[model samples]
Target: MKKKITLSILISEILNLISAPLAHAASLSDVYLPGKALGGSGATIGGFVTPLIQNLALLMTGLTFIILLLSGFKYITSHGNPKGTQQAKDMLTYSLVGLVLSIAAYWITKLAFVAAGLDFLF
Candidate 1:
């Protein structure tokens, strides 16, 4: 059924988001932000900001998913009502836009660092 397909897709997306952080966790910890040299530890910007960016992406993804869920719920509860359906659709659209913007921001930040010639694995 359509509902089943939607539910499965949502689950797949949730799984993807959950696994994302784990995938890049190693790189995050290895970041060495540049700062005042401490003893023998080389002064590195606060090191790398990949963790922050990753965490932010995760947060935004979660929020977008929540929005999508809420919109779906609204659509279901509307029971053929036109205005409510429209509202739900609008929410879905906005959430998708937000997700895209978050992704863009993440990449832009990374691009900025790259443009500056800073060497850090993203």
Candidate 2:
């Protein structure tokens, strides 16, 4: 029963992640970093900057999730052995570092986007 419930939750989370990008994709093709967004057709420097920032955000988020999965695996394998426990602790610590670094990266990027006068993410 417990295994079934856990499996269901895991499946739901996977489905949600798969569906999110489709839901949030922007429709506009001629973006111009917010300030100069009125210009049409030609690719400007500001135009590339927006896609770069958006992709970086997705990368950071994915990296954080990967770290979390590693930590979860470590925890699961740490059952009755001292060596396993230490390994798990190490993985968890590293995971925490990755998490903090990713959050800092996200905040800094968000600040940069605002400074660049582009649309902000929450």
Candidate 3:
């Protein structure tokens, strides 16, 4: 029951983070204007795709952060058990690696778009 409650809280937190950007919008039209949201001129391929890529990167980063937190929790709760401790350490390492890779990927993608002359969208 405690685990269930913790999981639910984590899920709700994630959902809230994802939706926080939209909460400030006054209308559906504001939410629909991705280009404007990103400070671009208007609707274009870059306007659409850039935000999509950014959002995906943000989501991945958030997931990695959550994984790191869980791994720490596991490590603390392992009580010196070698197997459980190892698993937690592995999870922590993997989450850090994933976070780095996702950030690099996001930068690489942005650079690619800029190279392709889509600087205005980014």
Over 59-109, each residue of candidate 1 has an lDDT whose tens digit, in order, gives 999999999999999999999999999999999999999999999998888
Quick one: ranking by TM-score, best first? 3, 1, 2
Each candidate structure's TM-score, on Cα atoms with residue i matched to residue i, is: 0.63, 0.49, 0.63
Off by over 4 Å in 2: 1-40, 116-122
Please write out the lDDT profile of model 2 over residues 18-102, one tens digit for every residue. 8788545534642333323334446555457667766876787787678778867877877867888777778778767876886
Alpha carbon lDDT at 117, candidate 1 = 81
Tens digit of per-residue lDDT, candidate 3, span 23-56: 6754666555555765657576776788899889
Q: Which prediction has more favorable TM-score, 1 or 2? A: 1
Off by over 4 Å in 3: 1-42, 120-122
lDDT per model, in order? Answer: 0.81, 0.70, 0.85
Ten residues in sequence with the least summed lDDT for candidate 2: 30-39
Tell me the lDDT of model 2 at 65.
75
